[model samples]
Target: MDGSDDKRLDDTLIALRRILRATELYERELAQAAGLTPAKLRVLQILSGRKEGNATPTAMANQMGVRQATVTALVDQLENRGMVRRERSSTDRRQTHVVIAPAGVEALRSAPSALQQHFVANYQKLEAWEQQMILSVLNRVALMLNAADIEAAPVLTIGDIRQDRGRG
Candidate 1:
């Protein structure tokens, strides 16, 4: 590649690294503020998104791209903290579901999403076409970086990074 192309590539990589670092730091800060580990907080967040604020452990494991054992451990910690409760599924008595307690909802509400706030604040200022362009570029970049193959959940927590590495 030409020198200008090399420079552009370097700049793009640096920007991506900055975004990743910011997300990692924000995850730690959010976890500390919520008095929970990132993984635990992520579990609660996933539960909170469910229709009834509950999900089966297997489902959570799939959503988080982690092992079921990892999700069980997180659920146990959350239950101990009174943030979640285990209940037998109504449709299937043989299955158990993890439900987020009222405290879990409160914790999630109180947690500050700094990265989201920053992104939303800036993103809202962009024109509609600009927003679309940015989304397209980000999607292309994700594909270029081979992240498209990863089964990432919609949750914004950084807990998946460690889980991904563990799998590798």
Candidate 2:
């Protein structure tokens, strides 16, 4: 590759690093501020938006594009910390819902807006052409890295973000 090609590659590497750094810093900030992992916070956000302030783990898993087992693990953490509790449904005794506790609501109020939420807010302000361009470029990059087929949710925490053990 020529000098200009090398420069472009370096620039692309820098941009990818910046995106990763931003996500890392955001996760740490959120953990320290609200003592919740991105996954847990996401679960709470989903529940808090519900009319009943609760949902089955399967429903949350579907919404998050993850497995029910993954959602169950997150719910288990929240329930252990008194942030949520499980209750059998009144109408469907066979169905159990994970209800956000008072503490969970308070955590949401205390935490910063999620990293992806901020990204979505800004992305929406871009022109249609700009949005399409970004999508095209990002898709190309993912394919270049052989990541196009990887499963991912809308959250932007990290590739494998660890739990925070409920600090707040």
Candidate 3:
């Protein structure tokens, strides 16, 4: 690539990494302030918005890209705290499903919103075309990264995988 092309590529990569880190850090702090580990909060968030039977252990493991055993431990902790409960799947009888408890819903309901309100307020004030251009660039960057094939393992963010087993 030419010098300008190389510079652009490096700048794009750096900016994307920084944005991801910032988002993860924000999520981690918010979850902690809500009295939850990041992983548990994500699990609660996932369960809260789902259909009744959808938050199975297998589904959660796949969504989080973790092993089944890890999900089991997470569920165990949530269950102990009365945030989640496991039920036998009616159709299979052998499969277990997780549902959020009322306490879980109330706990999460009291937490602050995820993104900073000021960011949204400011972003909305930008011209429509400017907003569209920003989104277009971000979409293209995401697509290009997704299409590349490499041997490197996917980087786990605080939300993607916890650091202190549950600290996010």
lDDT of each: 0.78, 0.88, 0.69
Q: In candidate 3, what are the lDDT values of residues 1-168, reduced to their tens digit?
A: 999999998998898788778767766666666656656666787798787634898888777667777678778877888988999888999999999998788768865565534456777999999989987986676578783332211222343343334442
lDDT of 1 by residue, 36-122 (tens): 655666787889889877899999999888778878877877787799999999999999999999989988887776466578789
Best model number under lDDT? 2
Q: Which stretches of candidate 3 lie over 4 Å from their true place?
A: 1-17, 115-156, 159-168
TM-score against native, each model: 0.65, 0.91, 0.56
Specify the highest-TM-score model's number.
Answer: 2
Per-residue lDDT of model 2, residues 1-168, tens digit only = 999999999999999999999988988899888988888899999999999788999999999998788888888888988999999999999999999999999999999989989889999999999999999999999999999988776778775423444443
Q: Is candidate 2 or candidate 3 better by lDDT?
A: 2
Clashing pairs in 1: none
lDDT for model 1 comes to 0.78
Ordered from best to worst lDDT, the candidate numbers read 2, 1, 3
For candidate 1, the TM-score is 0.65
Q: Lowest-scoring 10 consecutive residues by lDDT in candidate 1?
A: 159-168
Best-to-worst order by TM-score is 2, 1, 3
